[model samples]
Target: MIGILYFSSTGNSLYIAKKLKENLGGKIFYLPKYSGNGSEFEKIILVTPIYSFGMPKHVYDFLPKLDKSKELIVVQNYGGMVAGADYLMREYCTKNNLNLKSIYVVQMPENFTLSFSVPKFYLKKVLKKADSKILAVVDAIKNEKYNLPKKRKTKEKTYLKNMSNWYKIGKEFKTNENCVKCGKCIGLCPVGNISIVDEKIVFGDKCVACLGCYHRCPNKAIVYKNKKKKNRYINPNINENEIGQDI
Candidate 1:
């Protein structure tokens, strides 16, 4: 049996995970909600997006719990930069005793649209190309392709440094009057960093920077620090409800 454990913010990584499960017979598990090591499955894949050159906080914590005996394949998708994610994964596997078989890095449309919004037409073009690459990655995994990640000192250090910003993500976000106080973000947050306090939405420090609350907002109420209202980006291939389900 094959299992795919995935972490997605706006659906870029979810898009890849769904495609991989379509090609490779597997059960798709949401990383934050999934607790088991996946000892039942023979093959396991970790699909996620790179945040500031590193894995999301939820994915980073979940990686160590995976069963080492099963074959582990890692797939990371990013908007534009690769940022030495391969090396970071290699180091993580060594430290945690995980048997990482293959590592794949893919490019997708930039969804970080806190300030600068991406045109939907251009995002569609990017997704079209991404769809082709994802299939190729699936074939490679099927063919038993093995890869060794190259280590980079400078890039890895930068990656680690940038991760600190995720801790401050809660502080950077501010809700406008547009918010209906729907408390939707409370459910959408994978790490439980959001809640309704005193009948007001409150953000905590546990944010993993997945941006689910921002992109999946029904009223486009969440805004990043000091940024003018910009359009939010969600994967064109996946529906907003599916991403909001916290699966």
Candidate 2:
């Protein structure tokens, strides 16, 4: 059986995985909830969002535990650009003796509202592009297309340097008085880094910096260093419960 495993914060990766499941016969499994040794499937497709040109911390932690013997296809959904993330995943698989089959990158709407605003027109355009890209990827995977890592360019190198400070990102997230202590952030944090203390939301050091809580907040009350300038983005095709983190 084909197994599609994914780690998604705001549902881009999850949406892609669901589409793949519809085109190809497979069962979708959330990476954060997966605990098996990965022996349940004959083939595996791993999907995740690129965070600051790198893989999420939870994806990094979960990679070593995956079954290296199975045929593997890796897909990364990116908002802006995917720098060395593909190379990094390839290196990890090589070192772990995993049978990496193929890798593809899909461009999705940028949901990182801390830095800039994603206008509705631009978001719609990117989402349309993402759907087309996902179809191509599905076709390639169906045909068993194998690929090697591309030559790392100078731009990718620069992105890697810039994203190197990703660990310091979540520390700047702050909530305003508009917060009603709804506890959504506490539940939607993928790494369980958010909680309630003294009836207020608290962030812990274990944050993976996925931005799930900030984007998914009903009140749009969570801010990072400053207030948000754009509207919150959740995949228009996906429901809140479909992507909600059950922490």
Candidate 3:
């Protein structure tokens, strides 16, 4: 049996994981809630979004705990560029003694509202390409074609140098009066860094800067420094409840 473990804040990775399960036949495990040691499956697959060209803090924390004896595959979902996430995953696997079988990068819509908004037409095009790529990924996995790409030295080094900026990302987020106090942001936060305090949303330092709260806000109330909410993005195929169940 195969076990697919995924960490998705805005549902892009979750959508891919669901499709992988449909084609590859596996049990889907949400990484935040899963604590098993990978003993349940002959193969383990990790699907996650690229954060600052590296894995999120929770994913980095969880990697060492996985049973390294099982065959492992990693799929990274990115918006603009993957940078060095592939190399970072390979290094993590090597350090943990995990048999890294293959790595795939899928480009999804850019949900980073702080930087820019994804055009609707462009988003639709990306979704189509992502779906097609997922099918090919499933085929490769089935065939056990373990072809991992060589790391790009320059890009990887650049990503490593910029990774430290991720810590300050949460400090820029702010909600405007448009906020309905619906609490969707509180629940959608993967790290539970958002909360409701006296009818106002509050942010904590634990944020992994996934931007799920900003992208999934129903009223588009959340914004970054000097940036107004123009467009909110969530995986078109997944509903709000599917992405924000923690409430």
Please, what are the lDDT tens digits per residue for candidate 2 over residues 1-247?
8988888888898889889988997888888878885788999988888876667766777778888888889998888877777887787777788888888988998877677778899989999988889999989987877676775642444445645555466677778888999888888787788887888777777766788888888888888887656578888887778873321
Model 3 lDDT at residue 162? 54
Model 1 spans > 4 angstroms off:
244-247
Q: Which wins on TM-score, candidate 2 or candidate 3? A: 3
Model 2 ranges off by over 4 Å: 153-167, 244-247
Q: State in Å the error of residue 182, model 1.
A: 1.3
Question: In terms of TM-score, which candidate is stronger, 1 or 2?
Answer: 1
Q: Cα lDDT for residue 199, model 1?
A: 78
RMSD values, in order shown: 1.7, 2.6, 2.4
Question: What local lDDT does model 2 show for residue 58?
Answer: 67
Ranking by TM-score: 1, 3, 2
The TM-score obtained by model 2 is 0.90
TM-score of each: 0.93, 0.90, 0.91
Q: Against the true structure, whose lDDT is highest? A: 1
lDDT for model 2 comes to 0.80
Q: Model 3 — TM-score against the truth?
A: 0.91
